[model samples]
Target: MSEVWAERQRRTNQLVRGIARKVLEGPIDGNRLYGLCRLTWITEAYDAEHPAYIRSTKIPALGDALHQNFTGRTLDEVANEVATQLERPELETLVRSHTGFTNFYKAYRNSAREWMLMHEAEITAIFQRAYLLQSDADAQLLGADIAALPSIPKANHPHLLMRPEYLLTPACFALDPRLRFPILNGAERVQSVLRRIGAADRSVPAQIQLFVGLIGQNGVRDAADLDQLGLTALDGLGRADHEPMRQLLMHVPDEGDSLPLKDEEDVRRLQQALDVAQRRVHNSMTNKLRQLLANWTLLEGRAKDCRYDVLVKGYDGGDNDLLLEVKSSVDSAQIRMAIGQVYDYWHRLMGPSSDCHAAIVLPGRPDTATEELLQWLEVGLLWLEGGQLYTSTEWLEEFVAAVGPKK
Candidate 1:
C-alpha cells in the first residue's frame, strides 16, 4: 500500500482501538452495549470473508438473536442466548472481548449502568468511531478511500432496515470488484442498529447526530461528496455565496491534517473555475458589443463546421461583413488564437469576399508585441478599458493601410 493508504489505515485503527477502550470503560446498558459488539462482529466478519457473503449470511441469525431472544434482556442473558444459537466455538471466542460470556450479568450490571449514565457521550463517541471504521473498511474493500466516497444522502426519516443483501447488491460491488460483497454494509449496519433501537425518528438524538457529523467529517472522499458537504456547510453558516469556503471545503481531506492549498490539484481546480468565469465574461462582452453597434447585426458565425464568437453584417447587406473573435484576456496565446480564428472564419464563411473585415475583441489591452502582431495581421482590435469599450485607432489605421477602406 502507498504511504497515504498506510497512514489512513493507521488512523482508522487508532480510532477503532480508542472506541473499544471507551466501550470497556463505560457502564453501557445491555442492549446498547451489545449493539456496539454486534457492530464490531459485523465489521470483522465483513473484512475476514473471502467470498464476502458470510457477512450478510450471518446477519439474519444475529438479528434473530437480538430481536427475539435478547430484546430488553441483560447483557449476560443476550450473550448466553447468542452462544447457544450460534453454537460456533470460534465465534464465541471472537465475541468474548466485548460480550464476556464467561461472566454473569449480576456481577457487573449495576456498575455498568452507573458508568454508562455518567459518560453517555463518551460511550456514544465510541460507537461513532466504530461506525467510521466500518465506513473506512467498506471504502477500502470497494477500492476507494474514505476521503473519496460520497456522503450518505439525508433522508427525513431514513429507513433502518437491515437488509444486508440489498445493501451489498451487485451494483454496489460492481463499482470496484465483481466478487466483493458488503460494499456498503457498514452504513447499513449503522442505520439498521439505529432503527432497531427506536432511534430513527426525525428528531435524531444528539448521539446519532454526533455520529452523522463524524461521518460528514471523515466520510467524504470524493468530489461530489465534497461538494455536498460544502453546500451543506455553507447553508448552515448562511454563506452559500462564499467562494473561498466552497474551495476549501471541496479540497479538504476528511481525515489527517490539512495541508496549505498550494498543490497542483488546487491550481487545476482554480484554473477550471477561472476558465468558466472568463467564458461568461467573454459572452457578456459579445452581448454588449451587439447592443452598442448600430445598423449592424451580430450573430454567431459558423463555417466549415467551426464556430466563431460573433458575425457582423451591415443593414445595407453587402458582402462587407465583419468577423469578431472574443478573448477573455489579452495574452499572446489569446491574441494568436484570435487572429487565426478570425482569418479562418472569414475564409470559410465569407469566402472570396474582399470587403469583409476581421477583428479581435478582448477584456483588456495587450502588450506592444501583441498589438503589433494584430497590426501586422491587419486585424482590428477592440478592448475594454475603465468599464468602457475602445477600438484601437492604430489597428484600424494599419487595417486601412493594408486592406484599404471598406467599399
Candidate 2:
C-alpha cells in the first residue's frame, strides 16, 4: 500500500478501535449491537443480504423482537407479511414447500432476538477471547467457534443461511485490534489473491491468517492496509481508474514476505534508486519540453507530500496551469501507473481550480488502448516520436494555436 493510503488506514483504525473500546467491548445492549451494525464492515455484508429492509427496522428485529417499540411492531408486521407472501404458489417452487415456508416463518417468528438471547453469551465470550489469541491454534479455534455461530441471516434466502464469517471476523477485529483480523466478504476472493501471489495452498482460514502475518511483516499496521493489498492485487490491474497493480505485483513472493526487503539497508537502497530514476525521468522530460515549447513557464510543483514532474504555469501568458507527469516508458504498465498517479496529483494536489489541465508525458507513443484509456479519463497525452513532440488529437488544436505548433 502507498504511504498515503496506509496513513488514511491508520487514522481510520484509531476511530474504529476507539469505537470498539467504548461501544462494542463495554456492554451488551441495543446500542452496542447497533454500533456493530452501523460502524463496522459487518454492515455492508449484512445490508447486501438484506436489502429489502432498512437498518432502523432490521436491527431492532434482531435485538428486540418482542418489544412494543414501533421498530419491533413494524418488524413483527413484516414477518407476518413475509409468511403470507411465502404461501403464494409461485414461491412454493423456490421455497421448497408448505413445511419450508412454515420453517422460514418460524425462523423469523422465533425472532432474531430470541436467537440472540440464546447465543449472546457464547458470542460475547468468543469475541472477548479474541483479545487473548496468541498463535495459529488460537486463530483456528476462533475461526471454528465463529463458524459454529447459528447462521448468517439472509432476508431473501432462508434455507441458504449459514455461518456468519462476515460479521464474526469484523467483530473479533473490532474487539481485538491487535489481531488485525481481516474483514472477509467470502473465501473465494481471498483464495484467488493467495493463488495469484503464489502463496502456498491452505484452508481459507489459514490462508487469511497467512496473509495477515505477511502484511504485518511487510510493515502493514492496519487491517485496512491488508484489505487495500488484496483489492489492488485483485482489481487494480484490470481497471484503469484503480491504483496500479504493478505496485503490488512487482513484489509478490513465492515463499517469503509479500513485499520483501531483506533489511533497512535494502529499503534504503530501493528508495535511493527510485529517487535517482525519477529525477532522471523528470529532468529529461523537462529539458525536452523546454526545447519544444516556447513562451511557457515550467517549474516543479509540490502539494503536501506529493510532487509533480513539471508544472506549466501561465500557458500562453494566461492564467491556465498545465500539470505534466512524465513516464520513462510507454508500456501498458507504465501508462496505467502514469494515469492513476497523474489523475491523483491533478485532482487532489492541483485542486479543482479553473483552467488547470493534466497530461502524461511519455518516452514513446502509446498504443490505441492506452490512448483510449487516457481519453476516457479526459487526460491529455504527449509523446516523443522521431525527434518531434506529438499531442493527442484533443490537444493538437490547442497546442498548435495557443502553446505554439508541436516541434
Candidate 3:
C-alpha cells in the first residue's frame, strides 16, 4: 500500500512539474494551455452547480488529459474529453452546455493565445524570478511584477491564468524541482492556520514565505510534504502523523512565550473552557425553547471547521434556518464575537441565499449603546429577562407570537 501510494504521488508530481516547465517556456499554444487549464483548480469548484463541482471529481479526467495525445485538439474536443471521460453524463452535459463553462472555455481558447503572446516574456521572467526566491525582498519584487502585469478583461468565470493560485504559484512550485513554493489556492485555510498559531504577518506574500520558512525550520522535506501536512491539518486527510503534524502546525511561539506549544492542545483547552461555561447557558436556552416554542425543534449546526449552537428548525420541521449563538455575557467583547459568529454561521455555513435568521442570546440585556450597534448591523438580539425569553427584533417577536402559546 505504501509503495503504491508513493508511486502515485511521484507520478502526479511529475505531471505537474512537466506542465509547469512548459508554462515557463515561451510560445505556448492551445494544447499546452489546455493542459495547464486542466491543472488549474478554479474557485468555482466550491459551487455545486458549476462544471468543476468538487476538484477531486475531475481528477481521473485530468489524469487522462495529461497522459493523452491531445496536441491538436480544439477547445470543444478538450471539453468533450473532460465531460465524457469522467463516467458522469451529467457533468459532460454541463461542460458542453453550461453558459459559465462555455464562456470560460471560449475565452480560454480564443483569447488566451493573444493574451499570452502579448505578455509571455514578462510572465516568463516573473516566474523565473519566483523560481529562485530567497528573501522577503525577492518575494516582494515577484509579487509586484505579477501585480503590474497588464490586466486582462475580467471573465464571467475564471480561466487558466486568472488568479495567483490558479497558475503562477503552482507554476513556481513545478519549476522548482525542490518544491519550495506551497500552493496558495487554499489561502483562507492558510490565513486561519496562521491566526490559530498566533502569527502576526497576514499579507499573502509574507504568509507564503513564512510557510516556506516553517517547512525548513520544522525539518519538513519539501513543499510537497508541507502541502500534504496542510491537507491533513486543514482538510483532515492525507497520511501525515497527527501528533507531529500538530506540532508543525502549532510551531509559532505565542507572544511573551518561551517555546512553541501544540496548537491543537491550546484550541482544545480553549474549546473545553467555552463548552464548560456554555453548558448552563445551553441548558437554559434549551428549557426556554422547550417551554415557549415547543414546535420549533432545537438542533446543532456544523460548518466545515466548527459547530454553531442552537439551530431552530423551521415551523414545518423543514430546514434549520434560525441560528442562535449563546454567549455568557452582554459585554462588548462578547457581543462583538457573537455578531461575527452568527454572521459567519448564517452567511458562510448556511449559504448566503439560505434566507436564514440568526441572533445572539445573552444572559442579560445589552446596554443602549450595544443595542444600537447590533441594530445598526441588522443583527437580531435576544436576552434572558425575568425568567423568560425576550427579543429586540420585530421579526423574532412576530415569530414567537405566531408559534408559541399566549404569553
Candidate 4:
C-alpha cells in the first residue's frame, strides 16, 4: 500500500487528470472509450472483463495496449501526480493549484476576443483596430479580409485553430488526437486561455442594440435577458451585431485583501442587483428560445448524451433535425459537451437512425480545455453535413433567424 499522503495525492491527481481527459476527449460516446482511456492508466491492471472495455473479442483494448506498449507511467497521470507531490499542503495545495480546463484553455485565446480585448498588452491594439474597422464589414475599409484561418501545424495546440476577434466555423478546426498535451501544466495553459478567450470588442456597448430591433420582432418576453448578457460567453470570437448581451455579464469576486467599505449592505445590494439582472437574462434567453422553438419540438431538455448539464435536442425531418445545448456556462466545457452532442447528433441523424439533420447549439463558447476533454475523439469544428454551435444570441439572430422568428 502507498503512504496515506501519497494515496491522497494520487487520488487528487487522478481527479484532475480525469477531468482534463474528459475535456480533451469526451462525449464519451461509448463506455468502451472511457474504460480504454481513463481506467487503463492506473496502477492496477485491467480486469479485461469490464463491459466498457471488452465489448467483443475483436475490439482491441486501446487502453490496455497503450499501458503495455507505452513506456513509463502515462504523462496524463504523471504530470498531475507530480504537481500534487511537489506542491506542499499536499491535497489542499493541489486543489487550489489545479485549474479546470474551462479557465486554462483561454491561454490559447488570442488576446481581447473572448473578453472584449481585456489583456493589458493588447488593449491598445484592440482599441486601435476596432476604431480602424468600425464594422467587421468595414474589412474593405482597412483592406483586410478574413484570410484563410491558419491551421495547427503541430500537435497540442488545437485552440490555435480558432482565430481571435473574427468568428470561427467548426470546419475551421480539427479534433485529431495528436493535439493532446499533458493536463498538469496549468501555468503553460494560462497563455493559451488568454489567446483563445480574449477581451477585445468590434463595437462598443451600444452596438448590442441591433439584437434589440428583433425584441418585438420575435416577441421577446423580456429584452432584459439580452441586457443581462455580459459578452464574455462570446469572449474568444464574435461580431457585435449579433452577440447577445447575456454573453457579457461577469461577476468577478472582489479579490482585494482589504474590505474598505464599512457597510456590508452595500456589497449585498450590489450583488443582489447583479443576480437579478443575470436571472432576467437567463429567463429571457430560455423564454426566447422556447418561443422560437415551439413549432419544431420541445425546446428544453438534455442532449440525450450529457444529461447532467443543460442541453436541448429536437427531432426535425429530413437532413434538418434540431439539437441544442444550453449552457449558462462561462467556460469551454460547454463547447466540449456541445461537440459530443453534435457528434452523436450526426450519428443519430444519418448513421443508424433516419432522423432529420440536427443543429448542436450552445449559449456560449466552451471554457473546457481542448487538450484533455476533447482528446482522441475526432470532433471537428462543425457537425457532419454542416451543423453549427452557437450562443443564444447567435442562434436567435443567425441560425434560428434562418427559419424566421416567432410570430
Off by over 4 Å in 1: 1-274, 302-304, 315-319, 352-356, 394-407
**Global local distance difference test of model 4:** 0.29
**Model 4, which residues run further than 4 Å from truth?**
1-284, 299-319, 342-358, 364-399, 405-407
Model 1 worst lDDT window (10 residues): 98-107
Model 4, position 367, has a per-residue lDDT of 35
Tens digits of per-residue lDDT, candidate 2, 245-336, equal 12221121223223322122322433432444544544555556655553443444322334556656545355566767776667676566
| Lowest-sum lDDT 10-residue window in model 3 | 245-254
* CA RMSD, predictions in order: 24.3, 17.7, 15.6, 22.2
| lDDT accuracy of residue 372 in candidate 2 | 91
Highest-scoring model, TM-score:
2
lDDT of 4 by residue, 244-357 (tens): 212211122233333222112322333432344443433444444543443332322212322221122322232243444332333354454456555554564347655323
Better of 1 and 4 by TM-score: 1
Please give the CA lDDT of all the candidate structures: 0.40, 0.49, 0.49, 0.29
TM-score of 2: 0.42
lDDT of each residue in 6-99, candidate 1, tens digit only: 2222222332233334444545444444333333222222332242322232232234224443334443444455556545333343332321
Candidate 3 lDDT tens digits, 334-376? 6776787788767755467545578888878889998888878
Task: Provide the lDDT at 195 for model 3.
Answer: 60
Between prediction 3 and prediction 4, the one with superior lDDT is: 3
Q: Who is ahead in TM-score, 3 or 4?
A: 3
| Candidate 4 similarity to native, TM-score | 0.21
Model 4: lowest-lDDT 10 consecutive positions: 168-177
Clashing pairs in 2: none
